[model samples]
Target: MGSAWKQLPEELTGPARSLAEELRTLKDAAGLSLSELATRTHYSRASWERWLNGKRVITEQALDALIGAVECDGPALRALWQQAVAGPSGAEAGAQDTAAEADADADAPRVAGVQDTAEPVEVLPAGEPEPATAWWRRPAPLLACAAVVALVLVLVGLRATRHDDPSTPVADPGTSSAPVTVPAKPVSSDPTCQAMGCAHKNPKDTGCGKDARTLQSDVIGKVVIYLRYSQKCQAVWAAINEGQPQDYATITSSTGESEQALIHYGYDNYSLMLSAADPAVTFQVCGHQPEGNLCIAPMSDPAGMVASTPIPVGPASPPPGVGGTASPTADATASPSAAPTAVS
Candidate 1:
């Protein structure tokens, strides 16, 4: 952890650099120690160090692992990572090609205009043979080629380390709460227990029902409001979804049960799962390490829902950009109407 804690300090430009930075940020948001990450992912700590160094391009496998482990938006991160890996190298190659062509135009002699019917003349010194035509043999083109080669070598060197050790293997859903049919056996699979009163159970367990969907919160900083409807239990509860490193959201029912979740994967929106709460409920979103916990509570809703029109919320705003105060009946915070008496 000593040297691993320190990030790569070299000045890297383009996609590799950006990808490296995002990977480090993802690790931070996950809150897992390097040793723990090594254990969970079955990857060596040294391998992670290389991955974060910005010298080598991360493969799809590593990228997938980071996405799944952190519960991030996979498509979004994959797009960014692809840009970083392909962006710089392709750009540099194109740039070099353009520069070499430009140098040839500037350095080589050219005719003003010659028609295909006219014969071109080749001028050569009395004792000189034709020069080598290899593009890299020229001064300007050679320099450009050298630069490209150096970069390729650096990237290759980083990846070559992987071949040096072949032990690590890498490989790599939000929607709504709707009425679910209760199976006679009530087979619980992937239940997300998110509230204070809700028992945290595995989605695979036979407790929390299967219905899941994410609702948008209408606010300055887009908040994530997750809804879970359990048919077997015949109850529904809402939980705050978070993914940023600092910000969080929570809700408390009139019965005093509260559920909270931290932001995830540098995402403005996060996912949360909770068992339904008793009575009416209220919610609050807050930030971390501030002098005080400045939390904003959204409108509370009756356990039994009312006929209210859905007020759609947009992509969440960063916590600092948020405005206005939380309201008890704010359209942004929609509460669920119902829950089963017992999850079993």
Candidate 2:
């Protein structure tokens, strides 16, 4: 069945309209309902509706989540989103026009007619002579004149009280006139987890994925393995792409701590994080497939969290009798049988 998408607002045009249309297309291609999309992404259903309908601007995070969910080309969608955001939004332009019209109405000169609600002025007989009034009877005019005179006298007194003569020396206060220095507030840090607290935790959930980098990456047969590290969380994890259902990857740290995860859903999956606060510590990431196993030895870099020696990229398999090795703290051992050559 075709998607039953609501009509976008008439004001939405140009890049914004293109983005909204593309998002709707992706949603339909994924065969995900609005509620299902909401469940899979971080945004609420209502928020998704607003963004998809062009009623609100889509954030970068929300766009990334949507692309990831639908498994679409991230760079293409990101470029479209950037184009839409770089210019003034359609909603904002409409709002600006409305405000300008309201301001013009407010600043407009009103004529004395039906629109005017002020009390009408009294009209005496046409040619009749006006009666002279005493100053006391015209209290409003007299009071206004008296107020203006009083203001003038106060200004004169203030001017006379000031020491205008340059020859006169004023008393100096002992206090320093230098500006007071206020210490700046420290900037708030990101990543909710750190060090041991990040151990065994999902890197994405702990906000470590924002700054994560691949220390080592290698392709074995049809599957690719990545040794991912997060400097902010001080942790490392393993990720596998183009994996099978039973495919799993294990990441072992120098301290003998290891974490492993099996692919259960899509072709892409990652293992839980393991704390690696010391840069001197080495790590070994291994990916296991039905045919054989592949491992990369990640050398540590003292200046940064990057690995000094990255595994060569390309399709390669481990030597015979070389399977997934166990960490020092674990009791598992390698398989003695020779692993078969991987099929490209």
Candidate 3:
């Protein structure tokens, strides 16, 4: 009976067909019968006929067997086999088949029918599976959520701190802490000082002048300094309240001096005067002044003469005779005979 492989179409053309043609050419060139080729390749005659006739796809092992039977170049035939399996048709496939045949002519060995056992096929490695992930597991989305949560936590912490802590104590420009129970240092009395409008005849008098005077007498001869009118005053006051060392300048000025005098004295309200000659000079700062001036009032020595020496600049020390022995007190004995008695 004719071979069942004969059913292959005459027009069947591709890498597979090209491989079959090369096998046939190899057999003819070697002048070998099917039985002889099969014996040399260690394959059955039927298997050889079927493979060469293109009845089944040729495997690399089978191609290797055929190369031995025909004494053909193994590398050339193996290369052509690889191309044939890669694609069914293409110019490259044809070229590869042609090159294989040319190489086979040069190196093939003659063979008579012979049979040899086939080698066992090796198992292929299994394919790896893809890793699983959830929709929210994407790196970008996770990072964005983390950032938002951090921001929210920060905002919440800040809000809670603001509410729980005390309100920032407001220190007036030239004044100490905001006036809570006591009013700020007196600036000017009501312009209308008629008894009906303001009880004090001198509108400039602070209502607590007596109290201030009493405090001054007790601390006399100690360096008494006050901050002038400026943002710097607020800073100094804050520092003082904290019990930190602070340096204050003592300014001495008369009532009738020009506004420029206040500026030179580093005071906002120049209405207040400092008695450089007072055993202990008193600074009645205008806690409030439209022009933002710091008024200085230095009670004169009992004799009513201004002291020629400037007040020293340093941290405020405890009053003499109160905490410890007094530093040589300014001539407190200077008589106040000509000094103004009324604070106003």
- Best-performing candidate as measured by lDDT: 2
The TM-score leader among the candidates is 2
TM-score of each: 0.30, 0.39, 0.24
The candidate with the higher TM-score, 1 or 2, is 2
Give candidate 3's whole-model lDDT: 0.31
- List ranges where model 2 is wrong by over 4 Å: 1-64, 67-189, 301-344
Q: lDDT tens string, model 3, 1-344?
A: 11112333343334455567667655644555554554344333444554475443354444654554444445655555554454433222221223333344235321111111222111113344222211102224554465445435543443454345554222243754322221112333223222123221221232212111111211212222232111101101100000101212223333322111111111111123222222333333222223232233443232222123322222122223322211323221111100011121
The Cα local distance difference test for each model comes to: 0.36, 0.51, 0.31
Residue pairs whose backbone atoms clash in candidate 2? none
What lDDT score goes with residue 244 in model 2? 51
Q: What does the lDDT read for residue 187 in candidate 3?
A: 35
lDDT of 2 by residue, 202-296 (tens): 76567665555555556566566666667678887776644555787888887888987565532445778887787678888898988798888
* Candidate rank order under lDDT: 2, 1, 3
Report residue 215 deviation for candidate 3 (angstroms). 99
- After TM-score superposition, the amount by which residue 229's alpha carbon in candidate 1 deviates from its true location, in angstroms, is 9.2
Give all candidate RMSDs, comma-separated: 21.4, 30.0, 50.7
Assess the local accuracy of residue 179 in candidate 2 as a C-alpha lDDT between 0 and 100.
Answer: 22
